[model samples]
Target: MTATHTYDVAVSWIGDRGTGTSGYRAYDRAHDVDAPGRPTIAGSADPAFRGDPARWNPEQLLVASVSQCHLLWYLHLCSAAGVVVTAYADAAVGTMVETADGGGHFTEVLLRPRVTVSEPGMVAAAVALHAAAHEKCFIANSVNFPVRHAPTVTAGA
Candidate 1:
C-alpha cells in the first residue's frame, strides 16, 4: 500500500534553541514547514501551536483512523441489518509511551469510540456491528497494538 502528502515552508520566526526547543511543519518530498515560530506540535513556545486543542495529533491520528474505520464499517453493517443510522460521532483518544528499548517511541495505542445511533433497539446491534467492524478494520488488522472498542449508545428522539 502507498500514501502521500506534501508541505512547504517559506519563512518563520522563533527564538531560543534548546533540547526541546524545535518545531516541525509536516512536509513532503519537496518542501519543509519553515522553522521555529511556524505551526507545529503543541507544547511548543510558539503561540500558534497552542491553539485548537481538538486538532488531531500524531497519536490521535492513529486513534481516528481506527475509529473512522469502525464507523464506516458500522454504517455498512447497519444498512445490511435494515437499520437506518442518521449520524455517528466518536470521541477517540490514543495513548503513547516511551518504548521499552529506551527510545522515544510509542508502545501502544487505545481507541475509545463513543458512537451515537438512531432508532430504538439499535444499541445492541450497533455494539455487535462495532465488534465486526474491528475484526474487519484494515488498520486494526495491520497494527500490532491493542485496539479496543468502548462504545456508548443512545436512542434517537
Candidate 2:
C-alpha cells in the first residue's frame, strides 16, 4: 500500500508600498513563505522580473528543493546499504527557458554531488547509490523536467 503525505504553507504579499500595484512597476515583488514552526522564507521573483536580487527567488527555491530531496534520499540509502558516507555536498544547477511571451519553464536540473566515504572499498557502491537515490527522490519524481546526477565519490580520513 502507498502512504500519502500532506504539506502546508502560507504565502503573504508584503511588498505593497502604500500604492497597491497601481501600475506595472508600482509594487515590489516581495513576499514571505511561512510554515507552522519554521523560520519564514523571504521570497521574490528572479531579478530579471523586477524582483530584489538579494532575496530568494522561486526558481532558486525549486532547484534547491530538488537538490535537498535527492541528498536526503541518498543519505538514507547509503546508511541502509552500509556505505559510510563521511561528507556529502551537491552543486546543483537548473536551466530554464523563457518564451517570447515572458513565460518560462525549467528545462533540466543537474545535481553534481561530491561524496566522501570512509573507505576506498566502498567507493563503487557509494557511486552507484546516486542512481538509486535519484530514482527514489520525491521531488525528482514529481517534476516534469529531467533531473540528472553526476556524482564523485572519494575516500576520506
Candidate 3:
C-alpha cells in the first residue's frame, strides 16, 4: 500500500519599498516562521548595498526541497531494505526562468547527493536505492520543475 502526507506554506505581503526590502512572511499550516525584524530571504544584501539574501530565496528553497525529499526517501528506503546509511548530504541547485506571464519561476533543480554506506557491496545497493528514492520522492513527483539526482556513494568510511 502507498501512503501520503501533505503540508502548506502560507505567505503574506506586509509591505514593499517599491525597489526591494519588501516585507513578506511565510507561514506553515501551524503559524508564521519567526525570524529577525524582517522575514529571512536569500540575497538580502546586494553588492550595491541592498537586501538580496539568497538563503530564503525561492530558488534556494526549491533546491533545498528537492534535496530534502531525496534524503528523506533515501533513509526510508534504506531502512526498509535493511541497509544501514551512515551519512547523507547534498549540494542542490535550481534554475529560474521568466514564465509566460512575465514572472520568473524555477524551471529545473539538481540534487547532487553524497551518500555513505555502512558496509561494502551496500554501495551498489545504495546506488540502486537512489533511483528508487527518486521515483518515490513525493516532492519530486509533485513539482512541475525537472528534478534530477546525481549521486555518489562511498562504502565503509
Candidate 4:
C-alpha cells in the first residue's frame, strides 16, 4: 500500500462588523487559519475582493506552498547528492486571470530561485536538482497551471 498523509486546519471568520455581511463591502474578509502546535495564520481574500492587504490570501498561500515544497525537496536532494548548498532563495510569482463571472484562476507560477554552492563544480549539480525537485513537488503536481522554474546557481567559495 502507498503511504498516506492527512492535513487538517480550522478556519474561523472574524470579519463580522456587528451587522454582519448585510451588503457588499459591509464586512471585512479577515479570518484565521489554525492547526495543532502551529501559529495561527491571519488570512483574508485578495485585496481586490475587499480583503486586508496585510493578511495572507489563498492565492498567495498556494504560491508559497508550491515554492516551499520545491525548496524542501531541492535541499534534500542536494544533501543526498553532496551538492553542498550554501544558500537558497526563491522569488516566486503567480499570475491569475479574473473571469467575467467574478471568478479567477491562476495562469502560471514562476519560481525564481537563486542558489549558492560551496564549490564551483557543485553549481551544475545544484542547478540540475531543481528539475528533479519540481518533479517531486506535491503542490506543483496538484496544480493545473504551469509551474516553471528559473534557477541560477553560483559558487560561494
Candidate 5:
C-alpha cells in the first residue's frame, strides 16, 4: 500500500537584537528549528551571508537530509538481502554554485558510505545495495540535482 508521509518543523527567528532589520548588518540570522519531542537546532545562514559560524546552515542541513535518507535505506536493504552490517558511516558532500543574482542551487550531492559487514563474502552484495538505496531515497529523489553514492564495504571480524 502507498502512503503519504509528512513532516512539520517550526523555525522562529530570534535575532531581533532590539532593533529589527534596521540595516543589512543590523540583524543576525540566528534562529531555532523545533519539532515535537526534539531538541532545538540552532540555525543560521551560511557564514558567507553574515551568519553565525556556530549554528547549522540550510546548505549543511540539505546535504545531511539526503545523506541520512541514503543511510537508512541502505541498512534496510542490506538486512533484507542477508548482508549483516556491523558498522556504517558516511561523509556526504554537496556542491552549489551561486549566480550573479546572489542565488544558488545545489549542483549535486555525493554520498560516501563506509560500511562493515560481519562476513567477507557480504562485501559485494553490500556495495551493490547502495544503488538500490539511492533509487529509493525520498529526499534524494525530491531534489533536482543528482544524488550519487560511492560505497566501500569491509569485512569486520
Candidate 6:
C-alpha cells in the first residue's frame, strides 16, 4: 500500500517599493519563504530577472532541494548497506532554457557527488548506491527533466 504525505510553505512578496508594481522595473523581485518551526528563507528571482544577487533565488533553491534530497537518501541507504561514509559533498548543476515568450523550464540537473568512505573496499558499493539513491529521490522522480548522477568515491584518511 502507498502512503501520502503533505508539505506546506508560505511565500510572501516583500518587494513592493510602496507603489505596488506600477511597472516591471518599479518593484524588487524579493520575497520570503516560511514554514512552521523553520527559519524564514529569503528568496528572489534570478539576478538576470532584476533580482538581488545576494539573496537565494527560486532556481537555486529548486536545484538545492534536488541535491539535498539525493544526499539524505544516499546517506540513509549507505547506513543501511553498511557503507560507512566519512564525508560527502556534491556540486550539483541544473540547466534551464527560456522560451521566446519569457517562460522557461529546467532541461536537466547533474549531481556530482564526491564521497569519501571508510574503506577502499567499499568504493564500488558506495558508487553504486548513488544510482539507487537517485532512483529513490522524491524530488528527482517528480521533476519533468532528467536528473543525472556522476559520483566519485574515495577512501578516507
Per-candidate TM-score against the hidden true structure:
0.59, 0.98, 0.71, 0.97, 0.97, 0.98
For candidate 5, write residues 1-157 as lDDT tens digits. Answer: 9998788999999999888999999999999999999999999999999999999999999999999999999999999999999999999999999999989999999999899999999999999999999889999889999888888899998
Q: Compared with the true structure, what per-residue lDDT tens digits does model 1 show for residues 26-137?
A: 3211212244476653322212334234333345556767778877887888889976777677776665565568544445555555656677778788777878888878
Candidate 6: the clashing residue pairs are: none
Ranking by lDDT: 6, 2, 4, 5, 3, 1
* Candidate lDDT values, in order: 0.61, 0.96, 0.71, 0.95, 0.94, 0.96
Cα lDDT of model 2 overall?
0.96
Q: Where in model 5 is the C-alpha error above 4 Å? A: none
Alpha carbon lDDT at 29, candidate 5: 100
Cα lDDT of model 6 by residue, 1-157, tens digit: 9999988999999999999999999999999999999999999999999999989999999999999999999999999999999999999999999999999999999999999999999999999999999999999999999999999999998
Write the number of the candidate with greater lDDT, choosing between 3 and 6: 6
Candidate 4 residue lDDT tens string, 1-157: 8899999999999999998989987899999999999999999999988999999999999999999999999999999999999899999999999999988899999999999999998988898999999999999999999999999999996
Query: Candidate 3, which ten residues in sequence have the lowest lDDT sum?
Result: 24-33
lDDT of 2 at 131: 92
Better of 3 and 4 by TM-score: 4
